[model samples]
Target chain A: MHTTDTETFEEQFAIEQRLVDSVVASFDSTTDPRLKELMQSLTRHLHAFIREVRLSEDEWSNAIAFLTAVGNITDDRRQEFILLSDVLGVSMQTIAVSNPAYEDATESTVFGPFFVEDAPEVTLGGDIAGGATGQPCWIEGTVTDTAGNPVPEARIEVWQNDEDGFYDVQYSDGRVSGRAHLFSDAHGRYRFWGMTPVPYPIPSDGPVGKMLAATNRSPMRVAHLHFMVTADGLRTLVTHIFVAGDPQLERGDSVFGVKDSLIKDFVEQPPGTPTPDGRHIGDRNWARCEFDIVLAPEQI
Target chain B: MHTTDTETFEEQFAIEQRLVDSVVASFDSTTDPRLKELMQSLTRHLHAFIREVRLSEDEWSNAIAFLTAVGNITDDRRQEFILLSDVLGVSMQTIAVSNPAYEDATESTVFGPFFVEDAPEVTLGGDIAGGATGQPCWIEGTVTDTAGNPVPEARIEVWQNDEDGFYDVQYSDGRVSGRAHLFSDAHGRYRFWGMTPVPYPIPSDGPVGKMLAATNRSPMRVAHLHFMVTADGLRTLVTHIFVAGDPQLERGDSVFGVKDSLIKDFVEQPPGTPTPDGRHIGDRNWARCEFDIVLAPEQI
Candidate 1:
């Protein structure tokens, strides 16, 4: 390559690439190896992306402004960054990479930022809806090891949105509903009364929504219920059972979280139909779903 | 490759990789070709980074919180995201990729977020340090095309921190100094009185500062004077003339904006030395520097 320092754009670009090296090397002093690796890899990949696109200065300015808007709109009531991550498929990708599929363990999904540690404890087969407004639904499942052995007394925490597509936590009224924890029985069986999962947009009134609109992508997510299950000697599982036959599945879930294995039939019952435990109900429709969870042995 | 679904972590990992493909394909409906390219490339690069790092869930949460904090502290007066980009070297890299070095045209560096429009215009050899406190200095520069012809009347805009290391826009005190625009004379030469450059730490007290402290990096920027020059039928220049012997150059600049070609000597002068334009000064030292700018022909 015959060239002066910047005789051609390629030569000049080479100088630019070397700066990435300098940046990656800057992380050498990081005491933690993982942090160092993360920073360096991030530098490499980010630079590669910029180099690939020859990202215009205007584009870069727009990105910075976009992120600033995202941060400005975020507060205790709303986490726009999470919503941003979800829309970008970063949240789901992170979920995918972190939770390696182990022997028949229920495949994990986004542990959405809505999980509350102090959810009221409910007994098996009891109502977990706690007055959140939605169609009455019956849910039952078995918690078992990969070997099909019953895992008794397994802690199962479930949370979901109401028919209005808002989590109970989203309310400012200090109300808690549609969320609770219970333990599986000796036969590894558990049942609960909760509202049916409803398809909802993931907090789209923020910058992420603007991005989706700009890219011509839908902000809708298919209906699904969140579950976090833990038992002794088994890896904890965070997953969801999405409603089958939801039309959004064919299009795309905003978070890219829907998987074929996670989809289950949400059987709908006509108004005045008999409840599982014979609970009385006026004329109103309901749904029922079963999700059998398989847990992998704890690695440690 | 013989395997059942989720049989092994690797096999399952393959499924995770497929999600990246889907995310990229989702951009197929994007009507704008450039927007589609940027989004798809972004998705691929982002997913590649996540997979490469196998970033933990906790780390992901921390990152979201970090960005959120960064955004929260930003106001019209402060741009934490720009500082974040500076520390991460993204700003300089963008400058590199966008402004392909051409001819002897002053190599453009970071177009720092400090430039303001409607800067008061001044005549040649006039004082630009209006109401700003700093050691006096004289700056003279020639504007010429790459072909060595004078670019007479080229518009020269300059801005820099005062001795207190703050830009006029950074204060709500209703003051402006150390920044003004002037035009080159018929001889393509310009001169003005201003302050000597001073090194300063970027705004801290926020998440970007926390990140730098955690990684053992300094937030200090080397002393420099920012310059932006433009002329008709020529590419505009945004650059800085760094103090040649500033110690921070050996350590590191937070923004990685320094280039060897951009450094110039700010020679000190005795108080009573003959002023360049026959101006009177009390017992105070001054510094002087010369910059001859070369502009490339405007591409359009």
Candidate 2:
């Protein structure tokens, strides 16, 4: 056969095709259907992205640089990249899609980006609110089965914003002092006092903040309290119980953490009621609330 | 409500949730959906991968350093990262799934790691044989439209390795010598003289080679000639014309460059027969082969 003078553009596209072959060949064989599908889909999308964009020399370099920056920003206490994910709605989507909590358990929200293990422990009915936010308010809750039967000695941990809407961990140390951990009593009852809820803006100095500013968005979060409940043979629950009347409750609660079932109204009460801890308040205006959580079966 | 007096693991998870909320609240509405998806997926996968693999601090650091090295090795003339794609099969898979050749053009192959611009102009029938690899051979081909009409004055740029499997470009002037651009005559005929085809190993000294080695793979490629053809009324075509029976064809070209249609046999001719340029072969056997190229319509 005589050699042809010209080859078609299909011949040229072969270069790209060969690259794809090599890429798929590199993945490990997996039996997990989801993983397999995800890997294949990711490869397909990534390849298409490169081609659709006709990614060029300098553009490819810029992408590499961007990834490097993401890695550089991650640290022990700060995972800017993870924070970046949470803000992008990916974290919520992934968790929601993968593990739908609508089957009786409380809807799990995104695990926020800040946490310091080993918060100081306190007993039931102990005060956790350090003098930062405002006048004290009493919060009480019960840990029970779905039938309302108290689960004796169930562990109930709680933390909330100080009067100024900041947690103790946000500051270096001793400057904010608002974090507290508590466990339920023998009757599955728990109570504590702290400043009233207040709205506060999220940190705007990080790259996440910069991303928000670039698109003309705000970073405020509605007032809420953090809770973790667990007991023998029961599934652990991670949730945020929001204050119903806080101004930011409806529109400002970041990460879509609001659930009608989790919202509680704070009622003003006469300062002095027969207190379980024996401290009498002189009939002054005070905040009071009561709620109970039902435990789910443990998947483990 | 009063601050909580007790703390539990559930409470800690709640705090984590709040932090997540605060962080996610920071994203603005203008972020790219793809980027958002990518970041979120990355976070979930990375977080899961870490947990699944039980990645230690040392392992994580080493992975980071490896990425840093990949970045460090990238520069203007070479991209080790792309080579990473080649070995990982990402490059080949991407090219394959997004093949632009199915619209009635030649089968495509990978754009090997090395290709250069600036080929010197040579007239039709010019010889590109310079490096000392295989026996001498004459290559001729035609460029035509789908209807078999000749396309006059199409530019055909040719390149290939000497018998020893080293490209002329890899040798002198830090640039090769045999690579040249030739304009087809009115007959759409283009011809060049070069060494007979022989298999050559891709560069194994680079990171790609290292990866291949780690995976117990070889890097030999079948003998072939590279070309980039273009004309005023057609889309540009960049491809390779492979020599049949060079070995390593069916088992797959190590660089994944083989296409069934692109391969051709080099028929042996008596030493004394007149060659395409009317030059007699001197004392040694010579070979000849012919092929044609069909180009796509011009891209607007």
Clashing pairs in 1: none
Candidate 2 lDDT over B1-300, as tens digits, reads 123435433453454454344433443254776544444333334444433333333343344445455545555445566566555444454445434553446555555545667767766666666444577788888887655778899988777777777766455466555567888889888887766777788767765565456555677777788777888888666678787776577545665656678888888888787787887668889999887887766652
Candidate 2 lDDT over residue span A1-300, tens digit each = 222235544554555655664555544344554444444444555665565555443444454445445445545445555455555554444444333342345555555655445666777767766555565677887787655677887766666667665666566654434556777787888888765566766666776666556655667767767777778887666676677777776565545556677788777666665655666656666676776777766652
lDDT, candidates in the order shown: 0.86, 0.62
Task: Specify the highest-TM-score model's number.
Answer: 1
TM-score of model 2 vs. true structure? 0.52
Predict model 2's lDDT versus the native: 0.62
Candidate 1 local lDDT, A1-300, one digit each (tens): 245654676676677788898888877888888888898999999989988998878899999999999989888767888887877789888888777766567888877757788899999889988988888889998999988999999999999998899898788897889999999999999999998888988776778888888888888888999999999889888888998998878878988888788999889999988999899868889889888999988882
Among all windows of 10 consecutive residues in model 1 chain A, the one with the lowest summed lDDT is A1-10
Model 1 Cα lDDT, one tens digit per residue, B1-300? 245654676675778779988898877889899999999999999989999998878889999999999989888767889888877778888888878776576788887767778788989998888988898889998999887899898999988899998899888886777899999999899999988899988876789888777777787889999989999999888899998888888988878899998999999999898889988878889989998888878882
Model 2 interface CAPRI class: incorrect
Off by over 4 Å in 1: A1-9, A169-175, A185-188, A231-233, B1-10, B117-120, B169-175
